[model samples]
Target: MYGTALPTRPALHAEWIKIRSLRGTVGALTAILVATAGIQALSAAAGTVEDGSLGEDPLFAAFFGINFGQIAAIAFGASAFAAEFHNGGLRVSLTSVPNRTRFYLSKMAVVAALALAVGLAAGLASFTAGQALGGASAPGWDTPGAGRAVVGSGLYLMVMALFAAGLTAVLRSGTLVLGLLIPLILIVSFVIGGLVGGPAQYLPDRAGQMVLRSVEHGALGPWTGLGVSALWALAALAAGWLAVRHRDA
Candidate 1:
């Protein structure tokens, strides 16, 4: 078993370097930061606590930019894998790292790491900017579930990125992944969610968004909702791994 298992550090390092050298990766990360902060700031400024609605969730407004930021995150993840399928890039990569499992794992590791870092930074900045802009109307940092919401915002972005990356790998086409996912996330999920009711909460985007709320009224709790989203990501990853293992590069 040990003989068949290759060391992964070199593969990880190579993947990391590949990601760093890509200008698109940097641009995507920058978009996550800028779009998230800017949108959250605007939302905070525009938000008002309506009379007789003291039960409103301020955390939702603070992290509203996550709605837009996740698009950039998905783009980053999709592009990372999509590049491999272009210009015979997958063949070249396989030549250097023949073990498809190891190569795929390294690629995903890089995607997850970069997404986590960018997500965390964007989440924090969005929260800070929202708080600053919202002034007294903003959610208190000490509010019961504020910390969890902030941290979960970052985790949610990371998982969503991973989910996209996995789907890209399985589909072997970033264009397909984006076409299917962007609509599912932005339109279909929301539309169907309203009409379908309970089951819609189990959808990946809806499940993940649960963490962004300071108060929970949904069928799934915060952690449980995130777990459902993780299941979606994991299912996609398993399918992608099988594709890499048996399919021709």
Candidate 2:
């Protein structure tokens, strides 16, 4: 009575449904908004460039909350894929679609779309809150690099999330990816980044964050840096696909 099943639309829809229904996903999205905007607000209330403590670029300070918000973004992406490996969920999903490639793509598409949407919202919120709290010292919306910073903040978050998602797929454990990724981003990228100059700037988090800066000091420009992060995400996703295709479900 039923026809041959199609995987594209239905798989996408199923993936969306699964993502939306997850409490962790919802919480992660909320955390992104709260962390990004809250930290920016705190920074703005602290002082401005005039104080000689915040930094020269007010726009850079305006979006500073992204440093923490990106963690929530990573969590959201990692957990989404990790859920599949739980309780034989992938087996059930495969039974329905019977196409690993389609299923994986559908899930990733849903993840990417959702992350981008939430990321943009978080960026807008952070900018508005930060600038408002920054008062006269803050850069206006029409300032030379303000628009780019805001947009780049969103794109950076999305890309970082995707990078985490791809790595989670490869590792098959959100905990593993989070454990490794959090330390890499926090310690290695932020701390060692300053000490080890040159090539360290090309690290995924460091490269992606180049867009958030008003002043460019690295070899790669804003867009080029983000492109590097995107490439990392793509490479990780490809590796994940290969693992899924060749390994037993």
Candidate 3:
């Protein structure tokens, strides 16, 4: 019976189908693409002069839309898992899979895959649109760190989604997770970072944004900053896994 049980691949396929069938999921992804590209285009048109500050970072301008688009990514990830907690969805899923670890991991895997796909598409579209609008002022493929920044934008978005997903799993309520995270990302982090100075660099959003900078001199460099954000996501996932393992489904 164990040997004949559904495998991981089939489970992932089923999760994928479930994800695609959700209108909210599709809308969130569409929002990511449209908002990212549209905002970047506007920023490019406005154009920025190369000052000595971080504002001079061309890569930053190219991917500026991420500031807004990340909200959609977070929503996508949170809703994907949080829905399981409603209407006995998680209980039904567990009845089919039986293994809590396998079921939770499969759900997370699907969330990550979908987030990465949308992130990459949004990142590339933002880059292309920003460059076209910025003309000579925009960073090109030849610019130093341009490739990394462009690619890292996608990674940043993916990790942000995963972070939301993990937190949603732990909380078992998308509203609670979003309420905490949205404010933290959009407001509290920046306010505290501004008031406190250097420590703000370690905030998940700030740390991840490090990769988007063409010129950076902070304690955490691009890759290292991303690593910090990844750690945050992993920790959240661990907490979530523990929650699901021990809690009543």
Model 2, span 145-231: residue lDDT tens: 778888888899889888888898899999999999899888886677344238888889888887877777578888898999999
Stretches of candidate 1 off by over 4 Å are: 2-7, 46-55, 192-197
Misplaced by over 4 Å in model 2 are: 1-7, 48-50, 193-197
* C-alpha RMSD values across all candidates: 2.3, 3.3, 2.9
Best by TM-score: 2
Clashes per model (N, Cα, C within 3 A): 0, 0, 0
- Give lDDT for model 3: 0.82
lDDT of 3 by residue, 1-249 (tens): 544433499788877887888898778767877788778877677654233322556677678799888888888888888878889798888887888887878888988877888788888889888778777667788888888887888888889988998999898898998899899898866566434237778888888888987776478889999999999999999999899989998
Q: Candidate 2's C-alpha lDDT?
A: 0.83
Number of the candidate with higher lDDT, 2 or 3: 2
TM-scores for all candidates: the values are: 0.92, 0.92, 0.91
- Report how far off residue 219 is in candidate 3 (Å): 0.3
Q: How does model 3 score by TM-score?
A: 0.91
lDDT of 1 by residue, 92-147 (tens): 99999998888988889888888888888898999888777777767778877788
Q: Which ten residues in a row have the lowest lDDT in candidate 3?
A: 47-56
